[model samples]
Target: MKNRLKVLRAERDWTQAQLASALDVSRQTINAIEKGKFDPSLPLAFKAARLFKMSIEDIFQDEVSEEI
Candidate 1:
């Protein structure tokens, strides 16, 4: 998935570590998420949405096509 995590973090002047701390995740996890190398679990996604006061759809986007 492609997410606006980096942009959102930048808008708040937050570092990866800071975001990680806020989300109760490792900095590497934040980095991986930002880099699109990893996707967060549903619970984690909800936590992030709550933290950002945005819906999960506003943050993360599904990049895969639905076409079979």
Candidate 2:
């Protein structure tokens, strides 16, 4: 999945460690998610969206030619 996580975090001036702590995950997990090397679980995804005050669709989307 494609995500705006890094961009959003940047906008908030948050480091991976801070975001991870807020979301209760490891910094490595936040890094993995931002790098597109991992997709977060459903609950984690919701937590991420909540952290940014956005909807899930506002944070993640498909880059391929598939309907989201």
Each candidate's lDDT (Cα)?
A: 0.95, 0.93
- Candidate 2, residues 1-68: lDDT per residue as tens digits? 99999999999999999999999999999999999999999999999989899999899987773564
Reference-based TM-score, model 2: 0.91
Q: Which candidate ranks first by lDDT, i.e. highest?
A: 1
Residue 35 lDDT, candidate 1, scale 0-100: 98
**Per-residue lDDT of 1-68 in model 1, one digit per residue for the tens?**
89999999999999999999999999999999999999999999999999999999999998874232
Residue 55 C-alpha lDDT in model 1? 99
Q: TM-scores of the models, in the given order?
A: 0.93, 0.91
RMSD of each: 1.7, 1.7
Native-vs-model 2 lDDT? 0.93
